[model samples]
Target: MKNYDVIIIGTGAANIVADAAIADHKSVAIIERGKFGGTCLNRGCIPTKILVTAANRIREIREAAHLGIHVESVHADWAAVSRRMWHKVNENDSIRTYYEQFKNVTVYAGTASFVDKKTVRITDANNHTEEITGTAIIIATGGRTHVPSVAGLQESGYITSETFFGAAYPPEPYKSLIIIGGGPIGCEFAHVFNAFGTHVTLVQHNIRLLPKEDESVSAYMLQQFEDYRIQVHLNQDTLSVRTENGEKILTCSDRTNGKK
Candidate 1:
């Protein structure tokens, strides 16, 4: 068992604080389960924003014709986008190289679970086990998308924001997309797919889109969604979903209008 002055679990915004701790000459060890730079850099912000930017460029070129400016067809290549995202991710975060360069910090790529108050065990990539005893531990594991409970949802194949980022664009252009939640992730993806020529239908349990945001912000976004002709099913509950002849049929009940 090795010992350290401080151990940090996540490496996103908390890493900034840890850097400050290191500058104070406190011996530190960081154990990350996945990539460094945490969720924001690895899965959440970076890749999504990359896709959004590409999608927006395509949209702009498409609208140029309506402004009396004739433009050639807009194209988006999935493989090229994926390669660029991967390259940027690698350049921004290389954990192995960091450990080699930093003498004070010991990096272990593993699942770290607490055995007790002062001790933690990490199961590394090669199934190796390492134990560390730290005087202080900071847990910065961020939030994950909450896939709500709906009938027959678990067995049905679906994608969350994390998986969606890595997913290759559909081989053929899809005519329409039905997104389950009208929250940030869902709405953002709706915009991306819509820009790429897919009609989008956003379903929300709340009366307004982006329920958790400030009411005024939500109202503004709802108006934008309406302007974009993104179909919304507000205050509706999904009763069931069944795949029929390779198409998913969702049965929903509208709570506000008393329609099923």
Candidate 2:
């Protein structure tokens, strides 16, 4: 069994610090279960920010017309935007390359699970196992998408932010979009799609949207979303969802009015 001085289990901003150990010529090992770059580059921040920036630009253009600046309408191309973001995110050729080229670093792609306090078992994609021991271990499996227990939603073929990347833009003008959550992801998605000519309906389970943030900020965001022509539904319970013909329809009960 080969051993090392350090073992880092994630590949994010923290990796820079971990690589520093290699720079010092200390024996180093890193493991990743998925892409070389973690959630921020591969899944979370980068691509979403691209869409947000696009949305913001669209907003600026539309407002410019009202500001006495005549400008033609522009369209969003999700595929192109997604591709551009992915290219930049994957610029680092390989984590293995980083480890190999470094003075004394090694990288393995696998799942690292604790077998004991200072020891870990790494199971690779093919289920091959390696027992690794390190003086220090770091666990940095970041955030994951949380799916709500809405009726029939699982089978409804709906898309999460992960799925949204490969999802094609609606060819027909999206007359309406019913976003189930009003958290940051939901708000950002609402803004993006709405800016891209989709009429948006934002539903939140809480009394006010963005309940996780400051109350004033939530109220301000609500007004901003409304100004962007998004319909805000607060304190609504998602009862059921069904596919009619090809479109997804959500059955919801308004907590405040008891109306569906």
Candidate 3:
């Protein structure tokens, strides 16, 4: 049994915090299930926000005509942008490389599960497992995308922030998009895709876009979405989703009118 002074499960910012603050005499074994730098670095905010930046740039150039700038032929090279952004901060190549130089830090690339209070079992992709015993263990595993249970929603095909930003990057342009939620993430996607010339429709279960925020903000944001011709549906309880003839359809019940 290999023993360590401290064991951290997950490679996110929380693990970084635990790593940096440990006593100088202590050794650390960080167990990473996937990327070394966690979701914000590899999937969550960083990559998605880069796409947002590109979207913002595209929007600016498109609106440049109104300012008499006369910019011509503005286009988004998503494939190139993804390659540059991901490769620049890739965990194996860049961000996580810094820890490899530290003699006190050892990183394990596999999923870690608590065998008991003081021991963790790490299993790699090949199913080989190693048990590490530690005096102290910290769990910092991150989150996953929430997929609501609407009938046929999963089978019909839907893209959330995780899949669109984290997993799959469609090489070709997406002609139309129907965003399920109307919170910040959904709103951001509406803006980004609409700017990139995709028809965007936002379905909000709440009465307003940002239901948690002040009504004024929701109203203003709703106006902004409409300005870009982004369709907004409020208080729409999406009952189910289905595909027919290559078109995905949302069967929804209108909260305002009780019609489906």
Model 2 gets an lDDT of: 0.79
Q: Candidate 2 residues 1-260, lDDT tens each?
A: 76778888888765886867866777887888877667777667887797789779888987887779987767667667656776776755565475667757778889999888878899999999999888878777777788889888978867666565445534443667788899988898899888878888888899988888999999999999888779998999889888898888888998988899
- Please, what is the whole-model Cα lDDT of each candidate in the order they appear? 0.79, 0.79, 0.81
| Residues 91-166 of candidate 3: C-alpha lDDT, one tens digit per residue | 5445467666678878788988888999999999999999999988888888777788899987887776556655
Top-down TM-score ranking:
3, 2, 1
Model 2 misplaced regions, further than 4 Å: 92-96, 166-176
Off by over 4 Å in 1: 65-68, 92-96, 125-128, 167-176, 214-216
Model 2 lowest lDDT segment of ten = 164-173
**Compared with the true structure, what per-residue lDDT tens digits does model 1 show for residues 1-260?**
88989998877777876787777777788888777777777778887788788888887787788789878777778668767767776654665465436667887789889999999899988989888999999888887878778787766666676665456435544677789888888888888777777888888888988888999999898887788788888998888777777767777889877688
| Candidate 1: clashing pairs of residues | none
lDDT of 2 at 38: 73
> Residue 38, candidate 1: how far off, in angstroms?
1.2
Model 3 lDDT at residue 55: 88
